[model samples]
Target chain A: MASTMLRTSALRSTIRATPTVASKRARLAGVSFVRGKATLPDLPYDYGALEPAINGKIMELHHSKHHNTYVTSYNQAIEKLQEAQQAQDIAGQIALKPLINFHGGGHINHTLFWENLAPKNQGGGEPPSGSLSKAIDGSFGSLDAMKQKFNTALAGIQGSGWAWLVQDTQTGSISIKTYANQDPVVGQFRPILGIDAWEHAYYLQYQNRKAEYFSAVWDVVNWKAAEKRFK
Target chain B: MACNLTPLISPQALEPHISAQIMTLHHTKHHQTYITNLNAALGKLSTAVSTSDITTQVALQPAIRFNAGGHINHSLFWLNLSPPSSPDAKSSAAPQLTSAINKKWGDMETFKSAFNTQLLGIQGSGWGWLVKEEGKNDLRIMTTKDQDPVVEAGLVPVFGVDMWEHAYYLQYNNVKADYVKEIWSVINWKVAEERFLGAQKNAFGMLKASM
Candidate 1:
């Protein structure tokens, strides 16, 4: 009798899920992003700020052309996803995950990338102070050693990717990780610093010499910003 | 069983063609996540299967299929690729593989042309595969949606390429064609030949057993 009862209820539950799923999709279709459309984030400093290390032309192109494209595409993809959900197009919703990850990741990474640098005069080259200092020394032996480790990772990227220094939010553990293309340091890691190894970043000034670019980038790294994230 | 992350082809090793940044990031981060996530999902699936939790099993379908396939596909993908046309992977190195490809697609250029076109047409994250079907000598070109391993379709994957934007977006940028075109330079044909030979034994053995 209990088995029969469970079977009947299971059948009913399966049937009920259809309309419930459809209505939920309808609700999602009408929804907008919590913050409205994603917009292009302004760089905290001017394109020319990083100067010889990054160069103004590369920064300008990266900001205007690349970052903005992600913002525009992300808006379009989300809107389409909403429409697909409203119409109960399950396949369409499934198809949009790549778009959401790619464009959304592009927007997120670039926003973080822009702020992680500063003009050398604005404490760009300065090492972390306070708890961040202690953490760095403990985690990576010393700051200079960490820089070497970080640069080696960045220099070895096989394609377009970023090297990140991240702090795991839960364990408070720090690690150096590399991500392909615009994929942000995902899941539990809180990004402290990222070095964009995309060719467009250093192609104009450094060309094929990524090692030189990595070496030069130290001069404009904003340890102050990284320290804030570390905490 | 848990799928482990495959070790990477070093940046210095694949230099001059594929950048150190692209290769390192793709293997270490991208491929590693798929394996990690697959193991996690499979753990949950084990519990669900033991209890005969149909609802839970249904809910876990996408995660299992996507991640499991990702692990399988990427593992083969890494071996199937090496610094293209290098001595180990030279076009002439594998006589049997060359003859098989020629028999199916007429010639090498035609096969590549057709393969890249099929790969480019995938609407989103997917894989283009050259598969040798079980018990069949002739191969087929197929596409699997988002980490769907070709093995699930009763075929043995010979050559597989990830069409995800991250695969080429760094080096080729918006020009996916160039990335697809250049990838041929680093393909490990030697591995494909070995996979082909091994798969033949499996296919024929299954046939003999059934008969």
Candidate 2:
């Protein structure tokens, strides 16, 4: 009975969120039920700010072209999903799930990625000083050790993916995890920092020597941002 | 079977079109890792089969498909390229395949334009292939996402272009159109012709030979 009620409410919310239905209801009641659209988040610093570690051209393309594509694709997927829901097309809705997950995850991951970096002069690469530092020390013995493990995890990724430093929400234990493609870190884990392992991330500057790119990225990692997420 | 197949053409042979640095790393590091993972997955699969572990067997399907497809695709990719200086690089080297392509798209230029459109249309990691349809002379352009090989019965993959960022990012950066344009110069038409005219088994015989 509880599950049935929960399922019915979920279906009710879906119908309420449909634009055509919502707009008609809005005209009657003067209340809007439309959800806000996802948009590309602005980067915290100038494109060239991370220079030498990551080039301005790579940064520009990564944000404007790559991340923007994800934003646009995710929005399109959401629109199609709404149309499918309105048509009561179960197969169409099922097929759109992966697209929504991939593009949506891409947007979410890249937004966090932009925040997880900073220019060298702006407190980037500085070791965490607060409880986050203690947590890292407790988990991996030292900052350097944790970084080494993180880099190793990044290296082991088979294809396009991300390596994340996450804290288990239940246990508050920090560890390294890798995800394939654009899968977001979810369910019991809080993502503190993420490093994109896709070739587009460093291929321009590092070429095939990805280990160099991996090591260089640490020089610009925004520990303060990570610390904020940790708390 | 051990995954020890070597490229028919030397790594540096495709330079200018594709740099030696990219080729060497693509072959040595990236493709090698796929081979290693495929072997490991096969070993685990054998164990699961022997132990009758249906759950483990089911779990291993994706790894097996991904790694095996990677090996197959890379193997075909290497053979599908030729040095620009080689006679095999010329479209004239593939009379039968060229006629088929001309039949399908009206001319070579139109065919390549259509193929490039499909190549660039791929989002994220993938491959664009020119495949010969089942039991017919009909040809089609198709794109497969992330290491997926063309393995449908009777459809022969004449050749494929890797559209992964690693395939061109070092040289072309985000200008993928340039990479797609340049790759035509090094395409091994001779190998493609053979795959087009030959049986499906012949197209995959390289895998059997390696085994």
Candidate 3:
């Protein structure tokens, strides 16, 4: 499914690149050019793949409805920003910043989150080895200790947000961090693993017993993805 | 000072409209955490003020606003809800407020429709409110994002509907419209009536009691 999406996007890019007289005429008319649209990336595994830990129904809604809305809204915000820039509307552009930050961050975070999960059969929950393992031990004492800290951080988020296992870019030391309301992990921090704590992430499956959802998600954490980011 | 705010209605009272499980967790776990964090933030804030640590004091603003707003909002929320079966839940229980709604939105049904629309329009975590413009009987519908309490000078948050997913997701799932629809049944119009007439001073009697 992911490959199919990539192929379709590639075709669209080719079509877009074939600039003709009409395209030039539209550009001359001050029509905003379509730079690119953010598309929802296909899930690495099937919806039902995460099963008992995170249900298929929840996965389907979170991806198709919630995540897709962010992508669509983000594209709209970018389009409006271009128009605002053309019109030199400073306040309009400034007002659009929050929308862009929110939806754009939602896209970035969810893209990472989907990659950071796998079915048990696909080596999900497999303990890290080598440098990543050593770093986890060096920073957090043990893998279990890191997981506990991450869970506690996840629980502390008062509203919609994410908890991340991040490596500081300068020192390469790992730490747990949380951000509220679709704010992305950026700057000097390299996000190694992120667990979404938004109620929509688990309310359908676990309801108010979010602590259980926190504990259960570890069974599907894709350590290989985290290992790659760690290095 | 530690907060010891308790629900005016029993946790199980608002069942069906809001489940007992949801109420229990929303009150005990969610609201309690906010109070705990708010108390801690206040402690640090006092020390920061005493030492004139401006940077530390400035940094604590978000924590104070978020947690204190959470505590205030939830404290009001519990009082503004009653069992669906209770007389307090009826629109007629709030005659003056109902007349005010009629003056503003034509009638009770129209007012409710407008309120529900505002509730549904909220993106992410936030609240929808039926507010009375300060020093006047005029009412309007408004929304606040992510633990922002209605603190605009003169504006009174007569009552609010929590649009946070935690408020309804356990029972309503993704069909938030259903939650919005059912919430009207449990809305304690009696309390809203008191708020509309009595103004902001009466709104935080619970918080003042804690003081």
Task: Please identify which of the two predictions, 1 or 2, would achieve the higher DockQ against the true structure.
Answer: 2
Query: A1-231, model 1: which lDDT tens digit per residue?
Result: 354334323422321123444456546875532325666765666789899898887788788887887778887888798779878999999999888787788777877777678788777888888988898899999999999999999975544678999999899989899987667777899999998887677765765567899999999988877876786
Q: Provide fnat values for all models in the order shown.
A: 0.00, 0.29, 0.44
- Any runs in candidate 2 off by more than 4 Å, and if so which? A1-37, A82-90, B1-21, B24-71, B83-123, B131-156, B181-186, B204-211
Error of 1 at B10 (Å): 29
The chain B TM-scores of all candidates, as shown, are 0.88, 0.97, 0.97
Enumerate the candidates' DockQ scores in order: 0.03, 0.33, 0.43
Candidate 1 residue lDDT tens string, B71-181:
677777777778753775576766787899999889999999999999876644578888786657678889986677776545777778888656665676656688788
1 or 2: which has the higher lDDT? 2
Model with the higher DockQ, candidate 1 or 3 = 3
Q: Which stretches of candidate 1 lie over 4 Å from their true place?
A: A1-35, B1-211
Model 3: CA > 4 A from native? A1-32, A170-173, B1-21, B32-69, B82-123, B138-142, B148-155, B207-211
